[model samples]
Target: MTEMLAHELRTARAPISAHLFVSGFTYTGMISSWLPDKPDAACTSEETVSHLVERLEHGDFYILCPDNEVTPEIDRKRVAWAAQDIIENRPALSRWHPDFAERFAAFEKPDRNVEKV
Candidate 1:
Protein backbone atom coordinates (compact mmCIF):
# COMPACT_ATOMS: atom_id res chain seq x y z
CA MET A 1 0.00 0.00 0.00
CA THR A 2 2.92 2.33 0.61
CA GLU A 3 3.54 2.20 -3.07
CA MET A 4 0.02 3.42 -3.60
CA LEU A 5 0.47 6.03 -0.90
CA ALA A 6 3.79 7.04 -2.38
CA HIS A 7 2.21 7.34 -5.77
CA GLU A 8 2.37 10.89 -7.01
CA LEU A 9 -0.45 12.88 -5.50
CA ARG A 10 -2.06 15.94 -7.00
CA THR A 11 -1.85 19.20 -5.11
CA ALA A 12 -5.07 18.43 -3.34
CA ARG A 13 -6.30 17.85 0.18
CA ALA A 14 -5.37 14.92 2.44
CA PRO A 15 -7.36 12.43 0.33
CA ILE A 16 -8.06 10.52 3.50
CA SER A 17 -10.80 8.44 1.95
CA ALA A 18 -9.18 8.07 -1.45
CA HIS A 19 -7.45 4.86 -0.49
CA LEU A 20 -10.59 3.47 1.06
CA PHE A 21 -12.37 4.14 -2.19
CA VAL A 22 -9.64 2.55 -4.22
CA SER A 23 -9.66 -1.17 -4.86
CA GLY A 24 -7.32 -3.36 -2.77
CA PHE A 25 -6.74 -0.64 -0.23
CA THR A 26 -4.97 -1.90 2.90
CA TYR A 27 -4.65 -0.10 6.21
CA THR A 28 -1.21 -1.55 6.96
CA GLY A 29 0.19 -0.28 3.70
CA MET A 30 -0.36 3.46 4.20
CA ILE A 31 1.65 3.15 7.38
CA SER A 32 5.41 3.42 7.71
CA SER A 33 7.47 0.32 8.50
CA TRP A 34 8.75 1.72 11.82
CA LEU A 35 5.81 1.68 14.19
CA PRO A 36 4.82 -1.28 16.43
CA ASP A 37 3.29 -4.75 16.49
CA LYS A 38 4.68 -7.61 14.36
CA PRO A 39 7.67 -6.75 12.20
CA ASP A 40 5.43 -7.30 9.22
CA ALA A 41 3.20 -4.35 10.16
CA ALA A 42 3.38 -0.73 11.21
CA CYS A 43 4.80 2.42 9.66
CA THR A 44 4.94 6.20 9.98
CA SER A 45 1.20 6.36 10.47
CA GLU A 46 1.51 9.44 12.63
CA GLU A 47 3.54 11.40 10.14
CA THR A 48 1.33 10.35 7.26
CA VAL A 49 -1.85 11.20 9.11
CA SER A 50 -0.40 14.52 10.22
CA HIS A 51 0.48 15.48 6.69
CA LEU A 52 -2.91 14.35 5.43
CA VAL A 53 -4.59 16.34 8.17
CA GLU A 54 -2.76 19.45 7.15
CA ARG A 55 -4.11 19.23 3.62
CA LEU A 56 -7.52 18.17 4.84
CA GLU A 57 -7.76 21.24 7.06
CA HIS A 58 -7.14 23.38 4.02
CA GLY A 59 -10.24 22.02 2.21
CA ASP A 60 -8.25 20.31 -0.51
CA PHE A 61 -10.67 17.44 -0.42
CA TYR A 62 -13.80 19.51 -0.51
CA ILE A 63 -16.44 18.05 -2.79
CA LEU A 64 -20.17 17.77 -3.23
CA CYS A 65 -22.20 14.60 -3.10
CA PRO A 66 -25.69 13.34 -2.39
CA ASP A 67 -24.72 13.06 1.27
CA ASN A 68 -22.86 16.34 1.44
CA GLU A 69 -23.39 19.97 0.49
CA VAL A 70 -20.02 20.31 -1.30
CA THR A 71 -18.19 22.41 1.23
CA PRO A 72 -14.47 22.38 1.84
CA GLU A 73 -14.84 22.57 5.60
CA ILE A 74 -17.23 19.66 5.62
CA ASP A 75 -14.85 17.66 3.45
CA ARG A 76 -12.08 18.41 5.91
CA LYS A 77 -14.27 17.33 8.80
CA ARG A 78 -15.12 14.05 7.07
CA VAL A 79 -11.47 13.38 6.37
CA ALA A 80 -10.63 14.09 9.99
CA TRP A 81 -13.27 11.65 11.11
CA ALA A 82 -11.91 8.87 8.91
CA ALA A 83 -8.30 9.59 9.87
CA GLN A 84 -9.10 9.46 13.59
CA ASP A 85 -10.70 6.07 13.16
CA ILE A 86 -7.43 4.81 11.72
CA ILE A 87 -5.26 6.55 14.28
CA GLU A 88 -7.22 4.94 17.12
CA ASN A 89 -6.90 1.52 15.52
CA ARG A 90 -10.63 1.14 15.35
CA PRO A 91 -12.32 -1.45 13.15
CA ALA A 92 -14.33 0.68 10.77
CA LEU A 93 -15.59 -2.28 8.81
CA SER A 94 -18.80 -2.52 10.79
CA ARG A 95 -19.38 1.17 10.50
CA TRP A 96 -19.46 1.21 6.73
CA HIS A 97 -22.70 0.64 4.90
CA PRO A 98 -22.96 -2.77 3.30
CA ASP A 99 -23.27 -1.10 -0.08
CA PHE A 100 -19.87 0.47 0.38
CA ALA A 101 -18.34 -2.77 1.53
CA GLU A 102 -19.63 -4.50 -1.56
CA ARG A 103 -18.22 -1.77 -3.68
CA PHE A 104 -14.85 -2.07 -2.02
CA ALA A 105 -14.88 -5.79 -2.51
CA ALA A 106 -15.60 -5.35 -6.19
CA PHE A 107 -12.63 -3.06 -6.45
CA GLU A 108 -10.39 -6.09 -6.07
CA LYS A 109 -11.66 -7.61 -9.25
CA PRO A 110 -9.78 -7.42 -12.52
CA ASP A 111 -12.88 -6.26 -14.36
CA ARG A 112 -14.54 -4.03 -11.79
CA ASN A 113 -17.92 -2.67 -12.89
CA VAL A 114 -18.31 0.19 -10.49
CA GLU A 115 -19.24 3.41 -12.24
CA LYS A 116 -17.32 6.65 -11.98
CA VAL A 117 -18.72 9.05 -9.47
Candidate 2:
Protein backbone atom coordinates (compact mmCIF):
# COMPACT_ATOMS: atom_id res chain seq x y z
CA MET A 1 0.00 0.00 0.00
CA THR A 2 2.90 2.31 0.77
CA GLU A 3 4.48 1.44 -2.54
CA MET A 4 1.20 2.16 -4.31
CA LEU A 5 0.91 5.48 -2.54
CA ALA A 6 4.45 6.34 -3.52
CA HIS A 7 3.70 5.48 -7.11
CA GLU A 8 0.51 7.57 -7.12
CA LEU A 9 2.27 10.51 -5.51
CA ARG A 10 5.06 10.34 -8.02
CA THR A 11 2.61 10.13 -10.90
CA ALA A 12 0.25 12.87 -9.69
CA ARG A 13 2.87 15.26 -8.35
CA ALA A 14 6.62 15.34 -8.97
CA PRO A 15 8.90 12.87 -10.71
CA ILE A 16 10.08 11.28 -7.48
CA SER A 17 11.69 7.88 -7.18
CA ALA A 18 10.02 5.67 -4.61
CA HIS A 19 12.35 3.45 -2.65
CA LEU A 20 10.62 1.04 -0.29
CA PHE A 21 12.90 -0.32 2.41
CA VAL A 22 11.48 -3.53 3.83
CA SER A 23 13.34 -4.02 7.07
CA GLY A 24 14.00 -7.32 8.84
CA PHE A 25 14.28 -8.02 12.58
CA THR A 26 16.35 -5.23 14.09
CA TYR A 27 17.78 -4.88 17.61
CA THR A 28 15.47 -2.15 18.82
CA GLY A 29 13.46 -1.28 21.94
CA MET A 30 10.68 -3.65 20.84
CA ILE A 31 13.08 -6.58 20.75
CA SER A 32 14.52 -5.46 24.07
CA SER A 33 11.07 -5.98 25.60
CA TRP A 34 11.03 -9.61 24.42
CA LEU A 35 14.69 -10.47 24.98
CA PRO A 36 16.93 -8.95 27.67
CA ASP A 37 19.91 -9.17 25.33
CA LYS A 38 20.04 -8.52 21.60
CA PRO A 39 20.20 -11.80 19.74
CA ASP A 40 22.89 -12.57 17.18
CA ALA A 41 20.15 -12.97 14.58
CA ALA A 42 19.01 -9.35 14.84
CA CYS A 43 20.78 -6.48 13.08
CA THR A 44 21.48 -3.21 14.85
CA SER A 45 19.53 -0.04 13.97
CA GLU A 46 22.68 1.47 12.51
CA GLU A 47 23.30 -1.62 10.40
CA THR A 48 19.70 -1.63 9.16
CA VAL A 49 19.79 2.05 8.16
CA SER A 50 23.20 1.58 6.54
CA HIS A 51 21.75 -1.21 4.41
CA LEU A 52 18.80 1.03 3.50
CA VAL A 53 21.10 3.86 2.44
CA GLU A 54 23.24 1.49 0.37
CA ARG A 55 20.19 0.11 -1.43
CA LEU A 56 18.66 3.56 -1.87
CA GLU A 57 21.88 4.87 -3.41
CA HIS A 58 21.84 1.86 -5.70
CA GLY A 59 18.36 3.02 -6.95
CA ASP A 60 16.46 -0.02 -5.76
CA PHE A 61 12.67 0.38 -5.84
CA TYR A 62 11.98 -2.66 -3.66
CA ILE A 63 14.54 -3.24 -0.91
CA LEU A 64 14.30 -6.42 1.09
CA CYS A 65 16.57 -6.15 4.09
CA PRO A 66 18.24 -9.21 5.56
CA ASP A 67 19.33 -9.87 9.13
CA ASN A 68 22.12 -12.10 10.53
CA GLU A 69 19.76 -15.12 10.56
CA VAL A 70 18.03 -14.58 7.20
CA THR A 71 20.16 -14.37 4.06
CA PRO A 72 19.19 -12.58 0.81
CA GLU A 73 18.54 -15.90 -0.95
CA ILE A 74 16.05 -16.97 1.71
CA ASP A 75 14.36 -13.56 1.61
CA ARG A 76 13.96 -13.76 -2.17
CA LYS A 77 12.49 -17.23 -1.96
CA ARG A 78 9.99 -16.21 0.71
CA VAL A 79 8.90 -13.15 -1.25
CA ALA A 80 8.52 -15.24 -4.39
CA TRP A 81 6.42 -17.76 -2.49
CA ALA A 82 4.16 -15.02 -1.11
CA ALA A 83 3.61 -13.62 -4.60
CA GLN A 84 2.84 -17.10 -5.84
CA ASP A 85 0.24 -17.55 -3.14
CA ILE A 86 -1.69 -14.61 -4.54
CA ILE A 87 -1.15 -15.70 -8.12
CA GLU A 88 -2.13 -19.32 -7.41
CA ASN A 89 -5.10 -18.28 -5.25
CA ARG A 90 -3.97 -20.37 -2.30
CA PRO A 91 -5.06 -19.80 1.32
CA ALA A 92 -3.89 -16.66 3.06
CA LEU A 93 -0.44 -17.42 4.50
CA SER A 94 -0.73 -20.94 3.17
CA ARG A 95 2.94 -21.39 3.95
CA TRP A 96 2.06 -21.65 7.64
CA HIS A 97 -0.96 -23.91 7.10
CA PRO A 98 -0.50 -27.54 8.16
CA ASP A 99 -1.67 -28.84 4.76
CA PHE A 100 1.06 -26.88 2.99
CA ALA A 101 3.75 -27.45 5.58
CA GLU A 102 5.53 -30.19 3.64
CA ARG A 103 5.35 -28.20 0.38
CA PHE A 104 6.70 -25.08 2.09
CA ALA A 105 9.51 -27.10 3.64
CA ALA A 106 10.41 -28.56 0.26
CA PHE A 107 10.25 -25.07 -1.26
CA GLU A 108 12.69 -23.81 1.39
CA LYS A 109 15.24 -26.50 0.63
CA PRO A 110 18.09 -25.16 -1.49
CA ASP A 111 18.09 -26.32 -5.11
CA ARG A 112 14.88 -28.31 -4.58
CA ASN A 113 13.17 -26.95 -7.71
CA VAL A 114 16.26 -26.85 -9.92
CA GLU A 115 15.86 -28.96 -13.02
CA LYS A 116 18.76 -31.11 -14.27
CA VAL A 117 18.91 -31.07 -18.03
- Per-model TM-score on C-alpha atoms: 0.26, 0.84
lDDT of 1 by residue, 25-64 (tens): 1235433254334232222444335545665566544322
> Candidate 1: which stretches are off by over 4 Å?
1-68, 93-117
Best by lDDT: 2
Stretches of model 2 off by over 4 angstroms after superposition:
12-15, 113-117
Residue-level lDDT for 95 in candidate 2: 83
How much does candidate 1 score in TM-score? 0.26
User: In model 2, what is the error at residue 7, expressed in angstroms?
Assistant: 2.6
Write down the worst ten-residue block by lDDT for model 2: 108-117
Error of 2 at 42 (Å): 0.8
lDDT of 2 by residue, 1-117 (tens): 768877897789966667777898899987898898999999999999999999989878899999999988778888777887898898888889998888887887777552210
